[model samples]
Target: MLIAKVYITLKKGILDPQGKAVKGALYSLGYEEVKEVRVGKYIELTFEDGDLSLLKDKVDEMCKKILTNPIIEDYTFEIVEG
Candidate 1:
């Protein structure tokens, strides 16, 4: 089997309202040292093993097509044996 660890996040310069809200809450809760927060998505996927190159390509296609938004979000992934 193969394991994929994917992370999706907003692109730089994009406003993250959720992150800002959480940061504000943290500051109000006495966590004054907290400067900023950026919320993102983490996905773990398992799949059957095939040709390594083909598998990598397919995962990339999945990321571009369904896993992340091309306009405002970016993603990175790592593949490892499971």
Candidate 2:
């Protein structure tokens, strides 16, 4: 089987309100050294093994079409034996 591990995050220069909230919460909790926090998404998909190149293409397409917002987010994925 094949497994795809996808990570999606906001592109640089984009506002990250959720990350800001988390940072604020951490500060309130006295984790004062926390300089920055960025929130992201991790997704795992399991499927039958096939051509690695084709699968990678499909995963990239999926990320662009649905998993991430190309205009404001970026994604990277890795395929592994599962």
Candidate 3:
């Protein structure tokens, strides 16, 4: 079997309101040492073992088509054998 681990995050230079909210909450809780905060999404997909290159292409397509926004978000994925 193969597992695809996908990580999605906002591109740099884009405003992240959710991250800012989390940081503000942390500060309210007295965590002043935190300089910045960024929130991201993690996704795991399981599939039957197959052609590595083809699977990679499919996963990339999936990310581009549905998993992440091409204009504001960036995504990276790794395939692991299980």
Candidate 4:
């Protein structure tokens, strides 16, 4: 089996209101060292044995078409055998 671990995040220069809000709340709670924070998404995909090339292509396509906005977000993924 193979597991796909994906990490998605807002692109640099994009405003992340939720991250800012969380940071503010943390500061109020005495975690002042929190200089900045950014919220993102993590996704895991599990698949049976298959061609690695095809799997990578399909996952990349899915990320581009449905998982993230290419203009405002960046994503990375790794495939691990399990």
Estimate, for each residue in 25-71, the C-alpha lDDT of model 3 and write its tens digit: 99999999999898999999999989999999999999999999999
Candidate 1 lDDT, 17-71, residue by residue in tens: 9999999999999998997898999999899977878888888999999999999
All models: lDDT?
0.92, 0.95, 0.96, 0.95
- Candidate number with greatest TM-score: 2
- Top lDDT hit: 3
Candidate 1, poorest ten consecutive residues by summed lDDT: 49-58
Error in Å for residue 14 of model 1: 0.6
> Which pairs of residues collide in candidate 4?
none
Which residue ranges in model 4 land beyond 4 Å of their true spot? none
Instruction: Provide the lDDT at 48 for model 3.
Output: 100
Please identify model 1 stretches exceeding 4 Å from their true place. none
For all candidates, what are the clash counts? 0, 0, 0, 0
Candidate 1 global CA lDDT score: 0.92
Model 2 steric clash pairs: none
> For model 2, where is the 10-residue window of minimal lDDT?
7-16
Q: After best superposition, candidate 1 residue 19: deviation in angstroms?
A: 0.5
- lDDT per residue as tens, model 4, 6-55: 99999998999999999999999999998899999999999998999999
Error in Å for residue 58 of model 4: 1.9
